[model samples]
Target: MTKTIRTNPLFELYIENNILVINNGEDLKNNGHIKTADIESIEFIRELNFWNKILEVTFGLIVSVKSEYVRIRFKDGFKDLLVTNCDRKKVEYLVYDVNLLILKTQNHHY
Candidate 1:
């Protein structure tokens, strides 16, 4: 049987021969290399179901003609979204709707 793996874009991984490199929100330019065997676990929470679900639901809330940085606010917190090479309007709409969903879901989840 194959085990399922979870990952997020926030967590970066690179492998070279016997060396394994992992970068987690530090200086991307200064990523230190290490032995591949040294890495036993990698926890990427960026793709957590909460955020993923919000992204899916927020798919049409923006009214901008060009893509712009969107600030999404929720009941518990907020998030800044910026996806490279995407339709600006679509991204804004997604961010806006996702923010609303976050508030709605958090209320129910709690």
Candidate 2:
């Protein structure tokens, strides 16, 4: 089964076919994926300042929010961004699980 975490309409996360995909699953231009074996680390950054956070938390109830970003660093020195706009705690928990899934996928293949 495919696992998914929706942070943004465009910046969604998926774990399927031994890959970590970051996209809305339809936007070809935004569709980016890193092989489970190639992921070096996944780090989250919050850019939502007080005003931005207020805007995001309140406005997000009716609109899209773009405040957090998950930076996926690859072993080959390349990197990708997964912009998120959800609750900080939820995103943190989900990313932590993503890290675990990455390790699990790598171990399974080995």
Candidate 3:
């Protein structure tokens, strides 16, 4: 059975049969199947805002290619999933782990 891998208040991410599933609030929103053979690379980016090196806060994670554009809520505010005001380390780790799994699955197919 497919199980949820990660979730925030506004989104749920699931991994099943090497495919990534995203749900919004109470329903399925988008789905992407991993084409391990076609994927050239994966990247995870942490978004931050800095001014005069005075304040820096991590907001979101941006994934190359497949997850380039996504919107998610951060705290009580809404922002692009790639540009949020949520916990940075946590989101980064989650995306990294998911990418690893995708790569592992690709390797297994060969």
Q: Lowest summed-lDDT stretch of 10 residues in model 2?
A: 1-10
User: lDDT, candidate 1, residue 29?
Assistant: 54
The regions of model 2 sitting more than 4 angstroms off are 1-11, 25-28, 48-66, 82-84, 87-90, 105-110
Per-residue lDDT for 1-110 in model 2, tens only? Answer: 33344534534566677677666644456576667678766877766556767776877743334456667767667554545544556556656877887778677877
TM-score of each: 0.26, 0.57, 0.45
The true-versus-predicted C-alpha distance at residue 85 of model 3, in Å, is 4.0
Over 8-103, each residue of candidate 1 has an lDDT whose tens digit, in order, gives 434333444545343444335534565423332222112224544565568743222232233433344533333333343444343343344444
User: Predictions ranked by lDDT, top down?
Assistant: 2, 3, 1
Q: Deviation in angstroms for 52 in model 1? A: 8.5
Report how far residue 16 has shifted in candidate 1, in Å.
Answer: 0.6
Per-residue lDDT for 1-110 in model 3, tens only?
A: 23333455455444566555555553343444443334343444443334312333233433322233234322344334342433445455556656677578667879
Cα misplacement distance, residue 21 of candidate 3 (Å): 0.9
Query: What's model 1's lDDT at 22?
Result: 39
For lDDT, the strongest prediction is: 2
